[model samples]
Target: MKIMNILQIHNLKPQFPCTFRTFPHHSLSGSLNFSLRKSTRLSSSSFLLLLVTPIRPTFKIFTVSRIEAPFFENNKEEEEEDEERNSATNLTEFEDLAPDGVVYQNTLRLVECSMFAAVTGLVYFLSNSLSIENYFGCFFSLPIVISSLRWGVAGGRKTMVATAMLLFVLSGPVKALTYLLTHGLVGFTMGSLWRMGANWGLSIFLCTIARATGAVGYVLTSSFLIRENILALITINIHASLTFIFAAAGINTVPSMNFIYSLFGILVVLNSGFFVFLLHLLYSVFLTRLGMKDSLRLPRWLEKAL
Candidate 1:
């Protein structure tokens, strides 16, 4: 009996220890009821814990992933900034490499020269009086000379040679020979005039002096030695004066004698000035439309060429 009693006392002592750990003696009945309810909940939770999967190990992985997310965002931002910088650099490089205005100007000049030459050729072919005398009969030589002054010796020489060749081809052998001699003289004189470090005005003046000398020579030669044609003197004088006037003003020099000749020369100068002005205007408008800078640096080759 005493042994059974001692066993009962041992069980009661374990309950006392559990009650003391959870609640004091002064705890309310409700608190005791809550403690009993908590014990029941703990017992059920332990059973559930045995059946459920563990979650503690994955907590470290979740924390690391969360921390790395900001780095990825920073990396993306860095990439975007780098791209922007590269784009700006590329744009700057392009601007430095390519110049639009100079290219356009050169192209336009070539086209204008070609068109003028073609028109002159067609006019000569249709006139039926296409002889070396007639082909050169117009002040066309003046434009050739002036083009050199404007574009420089190389361009001028190129234009003059091209014009002479075209005339030769169109006028046949007799006219070609005469035209070549006359034009060759003009080219040599103009080239020499430009090469002498003369300004535009002086170049034109030199051309005038050359023409005047030629005219005087023609008169002396034709009147004294070659009496076959008296008209050659008149032709030579008219060509000289007309060429000087035509070159002084930028325009097509053509063979014509009268009061109208002066008016035509004035008209041609005005027209060419207008054409150049319009080209500049168009260039400005194009640049504005493209959002480009107003002033551009000249190309090195073009600066040297000019």
Candidate 2:
């Protein structure tokens, strides 16, 4: 019985030890699992937060001390001084023109005006003095065209006025009026058209129209006033001149006043075209020689030839 009891006691002791060992083992495992789960949850939450929130760089704000303010003030003053110097040196184109330069340009304009006026007066006198055809009167355009190209419409008008005054002084009012209507009007028309930068074709067309209108009016008025065959004589003379030229070219053709009158419109266009072409050539030469800028443009074909 004692041996049995001892065996029983030993078995109970071993059971208690085993129970204690199992309980401790299970508790340690549970604690380890709980800690691992907590760590996993914390790591996932931290990763999600990092993904959701964007990280931005921090900038430092600096305040200038009172001691550095004077230095900055000096720098600003220096910058302003440099700006003033640049402004003083870099002037606008018009402002950069010196007083002497202004005076010189004005003087040159006056000289040109005087010269052109004289030329116009001389041409007028020559046209009136000569008993030949009215072709000599066309020379009056020289000054008007030059003035227009050099100084624009205002200059042309001034020149026209000066020429008219000179004509009035040189010849009687009647002669002056005649010259103004017949020649001066054409010059003014051309100059105005040129000053406006009209295209070559349009300029020629307008000038031709003006010339034709003026010529017809002058002829009809003069015929009515004089009670003579002035138109017939003028047409006959023109026909004779053309016939002579055609004969010289080995084409003998006698032209009549009726035929000439019938073709007067066509003749005017051709004649104006020829005269304007010549005037353009003169203008090109004059502008180039004088180193003046002109906006006048000729036809592409005419440009090539000129």
Winner by lDDT? 2
Give the TM-score comparing model 2 with the true structure, all chains together. 0.51
lDDT of each: 0.49, 0.68
What digit string (tens of lDDT, one per residue) describes model 1 on residues 1-306? 674478577753222222212333333232331243324223333444544944322111223334344445877888999999999998776765454556555766576556545554445445547345454344444444445544556556666566556767887644444433444345445544544554444544444544444444444554665556554545566677877888889867665666444544455445434433342234334433555322322234433543
Model 2 local distance difference test score? 0.68
lDDT of 2 by residue, 166-255 (tens): 888888666666666666667787878877778877777777776666667777778877898787887887898889998999986787
Q: What lDDT would candidate 1 get against the real structure?
A: 0.49
Candidate 2 residue pairs in backbone clash: none
The CA lDDT at 1 in model 1 is 61
Q: Which 10 residues in a row give candidate 1 its minimum summed lDDT?
A: 13-22
Give the TM-scores of the predictions, in the order they appear: 0.35, 0.51
